[model samples]
Target: MKDSFCVTVTGQSLIKNDVRQIQHKRFLEVLDFLRQGNVVFTNFESTILGRYGGWPTKGRYFDYSRPEMLDALQTMGFNALALANNHAFDLGPAGVLSTLGEVWSRGFLHAGIGTDATDAMKPGRQRHGGHDVSLFAMDAGPGPGNMYAEDRSNGRPPRPGVNQLKTVRKLGVTKESFRTLAMLAQELRTSSLELTNYAQPDDPTAVIGENELNFYGTVFKQGSAFRRHVEIDPENAGEHLAAMQRAAARGDFVLAYLHHHHWEPGWQEVPGWVQGFARACIDAGASVFVSHGAPVLQAVELYKDAPIFYGLGNFLFHVPAEETEWSAREVWRSLVAACRYNGSGQLESIDLLPIVIGGEEETAANRLVPLAATGEVARNILQGFAKRSSIFGTEIAISGASARVSLAAARKVG
Candidate 1:
């Protein structure tokens, strides 16, 4: 094993246009720092295509980048990109294929989508500093069945799509809550058939799949009250676990990443099932488990000597350029996680670098640039990290300009 090596991770990056004009000093400094890492990772949040060639889909916004835009990411030093988010199918199968072609042609390692289910499940491997690091990407975004690739089951050919993990939504509540739901259902005159299986909408194009929203869920008894929970499909989890194990067997280091958009009632907190899912990944042989989605930073948890970043926020926020879907400012706050491991394969350091997103308006020369947060902005970003990670007992202390997370303390139970 190498004495030490760093792995840098970032959240969503959508380069709607070109990135050649960006020249922010601090931002470039951060990019240089990422370039120094053994493996630089980020979520390829948007597709790369010259024009839309796929069937029309249902989404408020669809994002596609020019081929030249890839030069910017390559210049920024992104070695691997995860492509299993909600927008993977924004432009449909043709878009997904185009995105894959662009990334591969650029010679960057990528995971999360493939020509078939087996191919999608395969991990992306890269050698850095003499250490073989493998990356496995999966997404659990809420969508129709077609969002994910399918195996050649029932004598059918394999399908082209993204790697997906299924989520089982359950309603866990007290007796009173169940009674209230029952009363509400009665008021709506909802029949049992409607509750169990929803009727397909008259317009087939209206729904991405058979259904999108799940109002009813299977009930379970937890002591005196009911427990509602959205758990990962055990079979799907097993498949991912097997993939992680296979990667571990072939590589010196393995990292499993997830693009999960599911959040708790309060958007700030991560769903309970995700926490378990992280641990399961670790148990399955992943040295690190990173997650991004929600386009906002969330909590950080260290479980069983492995680190789990629930959400990394947005590293490069340039999407929704045409139609307004999300608050621009809220999506701008972002960070870069630098993880270092010793020769013994133990995590030795984890640093959080805060950044503020800038657009062409801020800098007449650039479209979307992420500058290192400083002064009040730095403090505020670090404070936000502290607040979000505090729930997991991970503390972030201001260390010069960027904040440092004490992984030694994080080694304790979380």
Candidate 2:
């Protein structure tokens, strides 16, 4: 179309009591940057279910901002979406269908969803601004929950939008353990006060699709379990690397989005699995490997001349923004420091967008309030990136727009 501005997309959950509050404002800004034919994409963290599945067994559930949520995305000019985040299946298969229906219906590309693992791991791509991007995703631990297919004759993958773990180690299998695990599951599901699905006193909101709390409780009863290790095939790393080589040979860039939750020192502190995953994906031909689920952000790494965003902190959600929470904000800032941009200041790198939320509940009455600017977060993001660049010995830039960030940076080879 025009030039290539491969926009790596992410948002926590753009659905809440007033999810629409930022749709137009943010979309317009996105369009401003992407007017050259770049694809505007984001993580569809909230489900677009047609029928309500109730709330998650543990995590709170929320529906897409409005049925118009899809419309907004379309209007804003997004071309692709990630259905592999942890919240995709909050409502179950029906929820997956609803989201898939809307996304596909509206003409967007997505990876990580289906009735089984294969489906969930499928690669998706789109064309915008004359560039071609190939994106592949899998539930390293998060989801779109539709990994499983509809065929009942055999064992299928989990839903694309949901992740089906064989068993997680932190999860134990004792009665008290179950209670604790269940509570933990609940916390994971409803971590966000702003977007966590809650039945309103006056609204007709849908319940969460997946019951993360109960889902884990059942896992606890089943005894400590782990994922089946379906063998996403460490060999696939070579295939992807080859693909990346080909894409880079033909196009301006290649990006691979894997379900590597970079936060949670519990897992990532000793993040061997994620490291291997990143190593493999990068080896496959990826220019960048973005992640979420870490809840917190992580440092970036340059592997084979490519950059990896270990994690991107809360992007859509509006935290307290108080000085006490400065570290949380710093996490975003750190991401900005580590991002890659060409000298042009356009985000040349792709980082994870951890927890995107729907609205600005506190600032509804005061339009003049500075908090209303979601896109403004981009400025701060750039500043954060600048601060953290020293830690990684790289040149990255980040800019924030309230809750959003416009990150750009160039790759450095040592």
Candidate 3:
């Protein structure tokens, strides 16, 4: 292993265009910055199309990329990819196999989707710059159950799909509201047996402590106020953490990545459970933790000498012309994080380079390319980032068009 190493992490890439054709100066500069890291990581948000042949699965929007799209990502110097996002199953099992085949052919270190549950849960390991790097990736979804990978059992064949970190949504309601729901269930003659049969295999309808009820498939808990909670399944979480521990025990640099769509009501707010989970991963021996789902930057934390990025937003978000939701500035603003570790595998510092997708002049031709942010735009982005990081007691120092997290200072206060 090398005495020191650097790893670069960026937001999800939902690219569909041949961005390598772009030669904008700022965009090229971003590419150069990414190449500086021994391992450049990004989530490949779109599944490959046509090569292996498949039909579109149901989704609010279907994202399919051509084979050459991988070339564009490689051109940007991304050698590590997470393939377990919601869109991984957009074209069914064949699409998963196609994507896996294409990514493998390109010699990229990738994880997440696989031919079965065991395969999906396994980490992707590679040796880069004299460092053994291991990546464990999964998706926490409020998505269709069938989209997740399943192992073969009872004479059935295994399913090819994304690695899943199962989570359940619990609705917290007032005592009165719970009573009303129970009464309505009785009035409608809702059958518990039928509800259980229709529920996902891992989530069954049940009652708890006389104050909680699983009506239909939703679990409602009696509480002081109405709220929503996302609970990670311990068994699923344990499996992923165990994988990280095993990798770290082997003296590998472990990277844990999670993709989820369970955003807080305030899109930019980091969920408490996610914070707990990321910390748990570090405790389990992850060298770094990163998550993406909310299409906006959230927060960054330096915990126990490891960096945790709650959300990294979008890097290359290409959507249909009709998709105007992405036009919002927040969706286009993000930063590329370069983390440097010392000889003993302790974090030394982090350089945050603020970037804006499509640059100042966003047009059809350059809409999905990311460019370096400068002047007022850069300061504003870094300021907002600093404010968000402050929530976790992470102090970021802004300088010129970029920001940095120094390990010595972070340790002094952490």
Candidate 4:
């Protein structure tokens, strides 16, 4: 076995064009940095609109990328990709097939989307650095029911879509507030039966619980205090966890990736449920756990010698010029983490390089390119990242333009 295996992880990539022609000095430096990893990984966040043929599923703000974008990512030195995200189905089922075709044709180690639920849940495996590496990707979604892959049964055909880690959102309210809402529902005659009649077959109305009321599809429960809760479906989580265990039993290094839109009141705040789930992944033998959905850097935690990156923000956020909604500077700032593991498959250290998409220019021409952050910008990025990681009891040592997680200290405490 090789003395060490290095895996580089980055934030989601939403590229819509071929960017191989750009020769920006800083962009090239970022590319050079990416090439150092034995297995460079990223979440390919767009659906391909090519040979398989697809139509825009959304009325507006939907995205599709040309096949050449994969080539651009390959040129950027990404060998492994996670193909599960909110935008994975922008062009519908055909888009899923299109993305699978293009990615597979390039022989990239990719996972997360497939022709059926069973296929989608399978891990993507490869051999790198004389070690077997497995990656499993999933999306915890509040998306349409048809956006998730379904197994064929009876005489029906299987649906092609992304792997889904199903989650339920429950609005918890005080008993008094719950009674008021229940009365409103009763007065409006929006009972479960009434809503069921209007609901689509694929997305049925939620069943009312003994202490809960189903307002349309949202479930509200009486509780001690008013709060919003997102719970992972046990069945879905079990399936993914079993797969990770199987991969680990085979002695393959496992990387678990999750994409979700369940943001807390503060975008950068890490949800408690997510923190628990990430720890569960580490327990299930994941060498690293990464997630992206909220477009801002979140906390980093080291658990049982594994690194959990709650959010890495965005690496290549290529939205339409008119999409001013993503104008925030934090959306363009991110980190490139290189996790090194010894030959024994134990994580040794992690090097974090702060980067800013489009550098300091923030112009249309430099939009899709990532540049190494420098000077005060680099310090500010590291400072903010250190503060977030500190919340998890993880120490980040910043030196000059880069930072590193203190794995020795983390391991000692673990």
TM-score of each: 0.85, 0.59, 0.96, 0.96
lDDT of 3 by residue, 298-363 (tens): 999988999999999999999888777777788889999999987778788899999999886656
lDDT of 4: 0.89
Ranking of all predicted structures according to lDDT, beginning with the best and ending with the worst: 3, 4, 1, 2
Candidate 4 off by > 4 Å: 190-193, 205-208
Query: Any runs in candidate 2 off by more than 4 Å, and if so which?
Result: 1-5, 8-11, 17-31, 34-37, 51-66, 142-253, 260-262, 266-275, 295-302, 318-383, 397-412
- Candidate 4 structure quality by residue, lDDT tens digits, 204-231: 5354566788876778889999898888
Q: Write candidate 2's Cα lDDT for 244-355 as tens digits.
A: 5666666535566655443443422325556577777666556667766654445566665566665554344423324243333333322222233453323454442222
Candidate 3 Cα errors over 4 Å, as ranges: 190-207, 362-365
TM-score of candidate 4 against the unseen true structure: 0.96
Better lDDT candidate (3, 4): 3
Worst 10 residues of 3 by lDDT: 189-198
Please give the lDDT score at residue 199 for candidate 1. 25
Clashes of 1: 4
lDDT against the true structure, per candidate, is: 0.74, 0.47, 0.90, 0.89
Worst 10 residues of 2 by lDDT: 364-373
TM-score rank, highest first?
A: 4, 3, 1, 2
lDDT score, candidate 2, position 401: 40
